[model samples]
Target: MKQALQLLVLIFSLTVFGQNGNTDTAQVVIPGRYNSVEAQAKPYVIMISADGFRYDYAKKYHAENLLKYSNEGTQAKAMLPSYPSITFPNHWSLITGLYPAHHGLIDNYFYDYKRKEPYAKSNKKNAEDGTWYGGLPLWGLAEKQGMLSASVMWVGSASDAGGARPTYYYPYHEKFSPEEKVNKVIDWLRLPMDRRPHFISLYFPEADANGHHFGPDSKETEEAVHKIDQAVGQLVQKVKELGLKNVNFVFVSDHGMIKADNENPLEIPQLLLDKNRFDIYNSQTLLRVYVKNPDEVKKVYKELKANKTGGYKIYLDKKFPGSLHFSTKDDRYSRIGQILLFPEAPRIFLEKGEKSTAGKHGYSPKTVPEMKATFYAWGSAFKRNITINEFENVNVYPLVAHILGLKINGPVDGKLKVLKETLK
Candidate 1:
């Protein structure tokens, strides 16, 4: 009976995998790389990102494992996601230590006036193309310094950002179960010291998917949180069994979630719909408007300001609030639109007849507490029983680099001073 039940479970898992279609399960290896003598002697870090894991999800859902682990190590009140807290931008920011505007992935979807093309997260070619990315990610930074790295699935890992990819990596996909992912990490760590990755990244999308489909407060979202927590426990236990004393874990999330006002969704102003005047990219909480003629900026800005509703605010690119670091001065790639629209929480801009999801994000974290992400570190590298105040996500890059002894090649927004106290 036990064997029969096991077979039934295997069949069910295969059926679910088939539904997701054929995904590349093979690991992509870049040969002829080894950790430097100094790096091999340094500690290992396995940074995991659980997409859309809200700041309070663990405690709210009573995720026993995460709560215990964080209590034993370091926990933050909250991690502030960069402005326009969407997945692609925030993930890249976390990895590269640059603000979204500075890193050039200003939004998940936006038109690049210079390239005369649109960058959509759903476009495989655009996502994998290294030229679209800026700044050296953690993996690339490690590899450049003669240390090996790997990634299960990270935002920019698939792309050859910073002129190199992780020595071992898998392109973004959802076919791998949490157990499979943890096992993959174990396998990487089990390899010979010369070939094993010193810096590794793991990603999970369950919580985000559930939050968007069933709302942040739904039982489905809670279950997803619990699953992630359990996976963390499993990974930690497996590492302990391997007797890897130097391995450290840093768990984080790109952003949080909030229930949107789906029933009374905000409508796009008619002026934005005029193709002759503007090209628009809409992400519900934030809207980017590109003006065709430079001279028409003031005219359209004036008109939109008069027609603005209560749920959203419109701003000219040059006049964007400096605190958000999304203004013209901060746009390193000139990717930000001429005009912007920011929707308040619980209100999203949706077109007529288009359905809205129960949960949404992408608001400035300063304005909406719900947009704050999570940060929990529990490993030999971190201090124990320490809880720090809120800090921006950019600071995380330096903290990881410090632990692994990888030097930042250039100036990044993240400063080690902000998070150095968390470490021993």
Candidate 2:
């Protein structure tokens, strides 16, 4: 009877596993690239993203601790965010180290042609769906490599990427205060040594929302900035108090915020009549027009080009500027709009009447300083008192992988050499 019960348990587990409709059905094998290595004496990594924190925020608000952090560890003056430098795309880029295009998340709100479902932050079902998300997320990567990770309100952390999530992750929530977030991270760290996660991700978004409402340069924005800085300070103090060594902490942001040019805004819906003409997920800073009907691609292209009244430029999918790297080269992942409409920087588009918000991102990183992000890492793994110049955000993936000694089965857009200077 005991043997029969054990056999039944095994069968139950198998049945449950088989019922999970993971996008990648194959059993994951840790690839050769991520070879097993001598585990470090102390291996703890923390990644905190202050949503909408610009590279210059440290300077603008005189965030003393953050500035001192820059001085004490490796600091990148500005981390260039991926094109369409907005919230979700840039946040995912930091972890996966793949551009939004490569990751199959072209924009914050896009329609999944395959699933016939909409991908939006508010849609819990879509947010948790693995079919809409592609590539290996860092949390899932840690799970595969026998390490543990935790995320507190980080984008994509809640999602079922390839049917895997962090060992511990809470779905995105706005009610959690900055202090609560810091305390929760400490709680995770204080777990029994054997159970503690080796990696943790935390996110604070008050700054982003504040910036959107009051503009990046507003005094209201400063309040959010001050609050986030205080939270950072509190986080460091808690770690020091805990006396945990061999820990690495990385401070980053998805993208910066800029004042919107609401004075002379171009209304997209007014400019084009066909609202349902292709699932055009339009935003203030950018527009991603994914065609519902393949035949309409040509018609849409002609309509966009003739709209000389607008301040945006339209490009064929293949003709977008190479520097932006906003489209995928691989045929397997090529699902971006056949007709790309790129609005010039600072100036923005509106679905209806003028200014969408006081400020925004999702503009060309090249032209807008606000679109640039920040990267400052200080810990056991990073060398002290180093200041590096600007670099693209995609390289961050290899940096995290190198610190953890993780390997991937396939090529990642981020190269390890670019981040070699950052290691101790």
lDDT of each: 0.87, 0.73
Q: Lowest-lDDT window of 10 residues in candidate 1?
A: 8-17
Provide the RMSD of all predictions against the true structure, rounded to 1 decimal: 7.4, 10.4
Off by over 4 Å in 2: 1-42, 269-271, 275-277, 291-300, 328-335, 353-355
Per-residue lDDT of candidate 1, residues 274-319 (tens digit) = 8777777777788788898999999999999998879889899999
Which ranges of candidate 1 are over 4 A from the true structure? 1-20
Residue 420 of model 2 has an lDDT of 89
